[model samples]
Target: MELRRRYHAKAQPGQRLPDDVWTTDALGVLSSGSKRDRVNAELFRAIAAYRQVVAKFKMGDMAGNALHRIGVIYTEYLKDPDKGFQAYQELLAHYPGTKEAVNALYKVGAYYLEKKQFAQAVKSYRQFVYNYPNDKRVQDGMLAVARCHMETKAYDKALDAYQSYLSKHPDGKHAAFAKAQVAWIRTYHY
Candidate 1:
């Protein structure tokens, strides 16, 4: 409620526009307007509710779920990717043992990857691989690291990562692609 008001109806001069007109969804983060106000009002109330659950809760999974929803509400619905990303970070940091934490790891990596921040993406993916060694996505994360390297033309590093993946899982899901990348690097980038 407070955060929503600050960002929406009660927005300051800097936050609001010259005309101060906007259209939005429920959270008021989408745009700005009367209908926007109605929608944002509802959305803001939801965030307030989620926050309450998170603040006064002991159920790890429930708390984790609330945090995850907060992240989604901010990122996906409110159009605040940074805050949403922060929420995901908080979820992982506070609830490392939760399933939401696992998903947050991937979401964090994918967010960076989508921004073409290959190095950061690699770092995030590496965290996913290291933290959840036996996760089903470990191989995918490994391949993603290699692909990020390749995307940045770090052929040598890419080849190394690819080879590492192939060595770890000879017939894993990405084995064929890893082998192909390794061979391609050797053929051209060598």
Candidate 2:
């Protein structure tokens, strides 16, 4: 009862608190001079609460934005790659048609690339290309697919992807880079 009162009292007019605020505030409390055990307990509780929210909600861009924030926070601050990947994947699955989805797909692909998950990177980049064919990033996605294939030692597939990009976009902004990559790959093959 006291906790609810304190929480509600802090609410400003016309500003509704997000459900996660409870867990966040609890963490703040635990971190502020609380015992180590208390802090750990609060952290576990927060994780469980967040997981429940993630599971229960049918996410849109709003939730996707939240998930993106969670992913970045976990990846950068918490150093939890698995949780971060899960958050990103949730954004992709729940908000596939949103602007956030396009951005998330790119981010997930980049994440896979950084982790040297070349096949996963290609899969993500391909999906991005298929979904946003006319987007400015479409060319970049195509280029990334080729780069991922190249990194995974699939030289022929990389050449095909790069060649396709060059042919489709002769004067594109990334055309020179695509052509250069194709030339480099061809030289290596020869």
Candidate 3:
């Protein structure tokens, strides 16, 4: 109740919250409160803060961050995967080529994977790889491609993806795991 009051007070119409207060308030509840209380606080406060920023600036780096945080809160704390997906999609649609968009794309792919929508997961990950080939996530995205194939029981495609990943990123972080997967597939499927 008090938190709601404070949030409303700080986020009154036509009155933007101070940057410091927004940041502090968003973080404060997480630090000292119970886990459930902290998540509830984060969800409400982050939304208010984000709305205030967008209302004031229209769009900016901080607004992008706030949008990403809302997606995370929906997914991580609220356990609302659909809302999380919506928030992430909104970020990508609005922010387009920003770093936050890249992250949102990856997260969208992950959500698809979690939902067992392998085709959509592959598409999203491929989009990320195509758009940000130089980004560190490319390796992870490639690994996810192979994982999606494996999960969908496309052993041949999974093998192909693993081989491609091995060829391209021999020293990549997932190399050991990829190698193990290859050996497992050969032993079990062949």
Candidate 4:
């Protein structure tokens, strides 16, 4: 309750957020207490301020960036995966065209992957590739889908994904990894 009060008090609507707060991991260079508290205070202000920017000023990109930051803040800094995941999802829905969407997709997939939700991870990874075909990370997304299938011990799916990855990205960055994984899967699973 106190934290909620603090957040509301600091996060005044339409307040102008400072630029430095974004890069400030430690407001007082204090890791646990001041970092979290100060970062939350300033970031709450930023979130409020940017929300107004999106609503009134009609700045989609800026607001999308802000949403991405909020997701990161909740996920990494605040240790709240649920809120962080929600924030990321919000960004993807509201700002699908923004560059932040690409990274948000990756984070969302990562959240599911870290949770060992292999099916969800596969879906997210495939979505990442399907949605952002032009992105440099597209290969990473494709490889991730295979990795998710591999982790689930779906050797046939993994084999197909790895082969597809190798076909699509022969001599690409992860080619060796794909080849190695395919070899291992074939030798052991077959």
Candidate 3 Cα misplacement greater than 4 A, ranges: 1-35, 186-190
- Give each model's whole-structure lDDT: 0.82, 0.77, 0.84, 0.81
Q: For candidate 4, which ten residues in a row score worst on lDDT? A: 23-32
Ranking by TM-score: 4, 3, 1, 2
Candidate 1 yields a Cα-based lDDT of 0.82
Q: What is the C-alpha RMSD of each candidate to the true structure, in Å?
A: 9.7, 6.9, 7.7, 8.7
- Better candidate number, 1 or 3, judged by lDDT: 3
The digit string of per-residue lDDT tens for model 2 on 112-146 reads: 99899999999999999988888888888999999
Worst 10 residues of 3 by lDDT: 4-13
Which candidate tops lDDT? Answer: 3
lDDT of 1 by residue, 1-190 (tens): 4555555796544454443343343435444446555665677778888889898885557889998898888878888878788889989888989988988888899788888999999999999999999888899899889989989999989988998998899999878878887888999977
**Candidate 3 clashing pairs, residues 3+ apart or interchain:** none
Which 10 residues in a row give candidate 2 its minimum summed lDDT? Answer: 30-39
- Runs in model 1 with CA error above 4 Å? 1-43, 76-80
Report residue 106 deviation for candidate 1 (angstroms): 1.4
lDDT of 3 by residue, 1-190 (tens): 3555555556434555566764565567645567787668757777777767756764677766767888888888888989889879988887886788888999999999999999999999989988988988899999999999998999988998898899989999999999999999999998
**TM-score per candidate:** 0.71, 0.67, 0.73, 0.74
Per-residue C-alpha lDDT of model 4 across residues 81-150, encoded as one tens digit per residue:
8888987898888888889989999899999988999899888889898888888988888888898897
